[model samples]
Target: MSLALDLAPSASVEVRNVDLAYTRKARGTAPLSRFAVQADGAALASVPDEMEVRSSHLVRFSPTGKPATLQTYSVETLRKVEISTSGDTFIGSTDDDLYVFKDNKKSRFLSDRRANYTDIALSESGSRFGTVFCDMLAAHHTVALGDQTGRTLWTKDLPFAASAVAVSRDGSVIAVGGEDGDLWLLDNARNTVLKHRQEAAMEAVAVAGTNRVVFASGGGAGVINAEGQLLWFTEIVGETVALGTDSVARTVAVLARTDTNAGRLILLSGENGLPVWEIDYEDSRPTGLSVSANGEFVGVSLRDGTVCVYKLFYGDRLAAADGEAVLAEARAARSGDGSLLQAVALLQARLGSVPSDFRACDLLKETLTDAKEQALALSANAEEIGDFLSA
Candidate 1:
């Protein structure tokens, strides 16, 4: 099962889906076999019930080369879809309206709200779903399966005109970005409002981790905690964009326009409004930005039909410095010098590395080794600095 591309009469195909569909042509006889080319793309063992040829065009594809409404044929159309890290497929749907083919059956994770559903997002573990409904007005809901014969978990009324919805990897947090320029974070387990903002109209939103939310709205991007504290904010120039978040480390990656030219990926620290890293997409705008469950890599899908992957590492500069100080203390202790502790104190105060670096083993040893001398020196120097600090 490899991806097959249509040969434009006689042209080399650069990239195409390794599926059982392709366009081909021949001289006088009927067109050549469209499935002649051996496949080489995202593997698909069996076609799903709903197969839309055009992007965003939902269509149910029959094994015999027919397309229908996804919800029409109950047996085949309702298919559960799951994407594995190694490119394996899983089948299962939640309790909502949009059903998926999973476990050889049709399942749904959304409510059958008569309102038009605009967006849906599945949790990283496929245990929950977040959906947006636009009726006379718009609102959002996050649903999870309960531990009963057939029970479901739903959040309280989230009456925001949501543009997008995202759930955390652990399914602890659900975020909805409103088209009306408001963002709401919900605690799915407890059905509580963790945080919300009405400043920017959200264009895109993604759960960074368990407690962090990343949203792109108005002309800027910002991150907020489960408690709704504004961690950081920055500007990006794009009308339509995508966001990815890392909850554990509280980081965000924004795929937005760069210099009014092209789209780029900017990784920001959720703690401070500072950029950790960025990647350029040249003249292309991103359709999606996905961060892996492990938070090690991010995948950006561009409008030009290209997907790029980037590796990311969280940098704890203050923590590293603190670790160095602890090591110095340990070394001092091993050397039987008592002055090491005083040296550490002075270093920590001067460098402001006190609470951040708690794992200062070697530093502790060094501090212990010089403890006696340091204590004497401190006693003398304290008189000068103590009054200065006190004053």
Candidate 2:
């Protein structure tokens, strides 16, 4: 079967055999789908508690859709999780420990105080990660940064209990938001660079690029620069559920409830915090929100465990048309001429528009090697012809 999607004005692309499914009540917090698109244009999603027993699973799908399991990791009490831009590295926190999964190995790090982690964020490169920890007994909170091996680099104490934490794309800066309506910007050395006060309690925080950080508090959201100056602020109806930002795209995605208690996802410009687009859903509340690094897609995960991905267009007609044409050629050539180059290109293009499609990439790599060998043989024949002519 084929599906034609109108992603932007005057542009439509046909996707083949694409299907999506969701597992209900996957976890308390919404899951994150790393890059929205893998290197080969496949989409990847991380759903927590997919198999029960506090286990989380990584799933891969395509624009011409088929969903498949990529990997599964089990923990004692999974709390917060973040996936790297490449979708290969995973950082998560449990009730008392932090975990990092990379290269098919799992590493666990213990906290100094055995606190419950409330939120976690990772840099785009996945080399650094940060977490917000709450000390229930001490009635204090802490923000800690760690490397890929799960070693804590630095930890900063917060005056109020922190509700969310985020790190910049390059891991050079960190943003922490507290339940007491305070936002703090810190450097990599864990020193407070700037702080701002809001009107309501902070629910989420996300860092975009190097100079901007966005946070949601109660029913309101605001953007601030690294200098602590408020860039803009906007208020929405009902409670704010989640916030996400694409540092490369400089766009922010906010999830909130309506007056009637319906869920709505709003896309805003990170530069000035202006609304770009908004979508409403009648069934479930959004538990998580994410935007692709290129601002090409936004993903929303609902309370019922449904993860929906939408394509965003910034007016590249040539790229869109080329992607569509290559996808069509790849689909047709799948059982015909076997053009590995076209397939590889199609996969790469598809990833820019969708989430993960690792299976397609894996399958096409073998064909790519064969194609390379055939080209080498043809080059050898050409060289022989040249030598014969010379003789």
Best by lDDT: 2
Error of 2 at 283 (Å): 1.5
Q: lDDT by residue for model 2 over 130-179, one digit each (tens)? A: 88887767587888888888888988778897887888878898888888
Q: Which TM-score value belongs to model 1? A: 0.53
- Tell me the alpha-carbon RMSD of every candidate: 19.1, 17.9
TM-score of 2: 0.68
TM-score of each: 0.53, 0.68
The candidate that achieves the highest TM-score relative to the unseen native structure: 2
lDDT at residue 327 of model 2 (Cα atoms) = 60
Candidate 1's residue-wise lDDT over 1-391, tens digit each? 1111211112111111012222111111111010101112111112222354211212222223433323222332322232222221122232234554333344443344444555556554445555565553433433332211112475355555667776665556767777677776666664557657656677877776555666777677776665676665676655646666543544456777664547776665455544545556677555555555545555554445444445443332443344455566545644567444555565455334322222342354445556667678889898989999999
